[model samples]
Target chain A: DAGVTQSPTHLIKTRGQQVTLRCSPISGHKSVSWYQQVLGQGPQFIFQYYEKEERGRGNFPDRFSARQFPNYSSELNVNALLLGDSALYLCASSFPSSRASDTQYFGPGTRLTVL
Target chain B: AQTVTQSQPEMSVQEAETVTLSCTYDTSESNYYLFWYKQPPSRQMILVIRQEAYKQQNATENRFSVNFQKAAKSFSLKISDSQLGDTAMYFCAFMKQGSGGGADGLTFGKGTHLIIQP
Candidate 1:
């Protein structure tokens, strides 16, 4: 079984631009979450979707948004990007049955560089 | 809001030696979870170990183990017989137990950089 997978391994965008990052969860997973990791720092939670419904959201600004599809795939969108937005965006997936204490498996992550 | 803190920014251990990474978190919830994740240069976040606040016994996975102190709100990782592959950035994370089986995203620390000397 493949782990979570992400698209556009790396990206470069100018300030004020918008970008979308995609993620495909494991075959049997139903929960997908997004996190942002700045250089030399640990990842910060962004949003989580379970069964195609938004479950939780972090302290990120309104510019950041995400949605999950029927197949449990997810996309993270960032609008009006600022240089501070440059970071590694990670996607994680977990089984819905063990939602409370399930271990989350993470993707390789998409590196976004805003200039 | 819960917060995870890793005081040591960097640490090094010789091959076959043992090393421990400390983590402290602040939370008001009685039931929660703690995790240790390893991020190599490849940027893949790998689950190292986890502990449930309700359990008194610590969690051990192969060469990795955790020292979970509920009273102190501390969860530390100890790696025995360390190998060169153990060199990576390790993060400590927390999650509160929510009702309705809803999943809450993790709250992570700044991370500790571990170097295994061969």
Candidate 2:
């Protein structure tokens, strides 16, 4: 079966522009989370939504926001992008019923470049 | 807050040799879970091995295993007979147990780059 899937594998935007990345979770998965990974650093959590509700949020700025759909798909939106915002945006999903610490599977990630 | 740590920035090992990546984490709660994730050049994060806080026996998955010390909050991954395909950035992660936080996902370490020489 297919694992997680992400759209717009790569994107380029200028400062102050907005971008939205999408992700489709594995079949039957109900939880989705977003992370931002700057070059040379590990991913930092952004937002997490489960069953279409905000389950958790990271220490990110107001420019970052996300929403999960009823079908378990998710979207991560960044507003007023800055050059420092250029990074890989990763989407991960998991099933809460049968959970493991790392059972969360990740998509290939969206490579965002801001000028 | 839970925090995972990986001290080694990079490591190299012969194709047939073995290598161990160290990971330690800090958590106030006693019950939790630890994980080792591998991210290749493709940038898709994959689970390598996992350890439950309460389990006494260390976890093993074929050539992959973990040295889990619940008391010390230490969890290290060991890879035997490394292969070129195993080269990736290794991240140590932690998830607090039953935190009711739902989908916070995992707290990851800075990660270590593992290179397998062929």
Candidate 3:
């Protein structure tokens, strides 16, 4: 089966603008998570959705938001984008039934650049 | 909140030689999990190995093995016969066991860049 998939492999926006990133979880997976990876640093968790409900959220600001669809796909929206918002946005998926020890599979990520 | 640390910013080793990358994490939760993920220039995070806090034995996958010390809070990865393909950014991550059935987000370290010299 295919791994988690993300869209618009790359994106560019100016400061004060907005952008939406999309993700499709792996088949049969019920949970999706979002992470932001700045250049030369590790990824930081942004949001996690399970069974179409918001399960967890990271320390990111309110300008960042996400939602999961009935099909388990997810979208991350960043408003009032700052230069600091430029980073590779990653999406991960896992089976909720597997519980805590489940390993999340990540996507190639959407590279967002803000000028 | 939990914090994962990778002290080594970078490391270089000759091909076919063994190298060990170190990591340490701070967490009050006893039923947590630790992981080592590798990200090549391609930029997708790949799971190398994982260890559960409750497990006494370390996790091993092919040439990859982990030394998981629950007390010391140290989790290190050892690569045997390292190959050029092994070159990548290595990250140590932590996840607290959640009471709910959903998966939790991972807290990652800054990562160590590992170079396998040819």
Question: For model 3, what is the alpha-carbon lDDT of residue B98?
Answer: 71
lDDT against the true structure, each candidate: 0.91, 0.87, 0.91
| Top-lDDT candidate index | 1
Please, what are the lDDT tens digits per residue for candidate 3 over residues A1-115? 8888999899999999999999998898888999999999999999989889889989999999999999999999999999999999999888856445367779999999999
Candidates sorted by TM-score, best first: 3, 1, 2
Give stretches of model 3 more than 4 Å off.
A99-101, B100-104
Clashing residue pairs, backbone N/CA/C < 3 A, model 2 = none
Q: Where is model 2 more than 4 Å wrong at Cα? A: A99-102, B99-101
Candidate 3, position A104, lDDT: 78
Q: Over the true interface residues, superposed, what is the Cα RMSD of model 1?
A: 2.2
CA lDDT of A26 in candidate 1?
Answer: 91
TM-score of chain A of 1: 0.96
Question: Please, what is the TM-score per model?
Answer: 0.96, 0.96, 0.97
lDDT of 1 by residue, A10-103 (tens): 9999999999999999998888999999999889889999899899988899999999999989999999999999999999988857545377
Angstrom error at residue A9, model 3: 0.7
For model 1 chain B, where is the 10-residue window of minimal lDDT? Answer: B95-104
Better of 1 and 3 by DockQ: 1
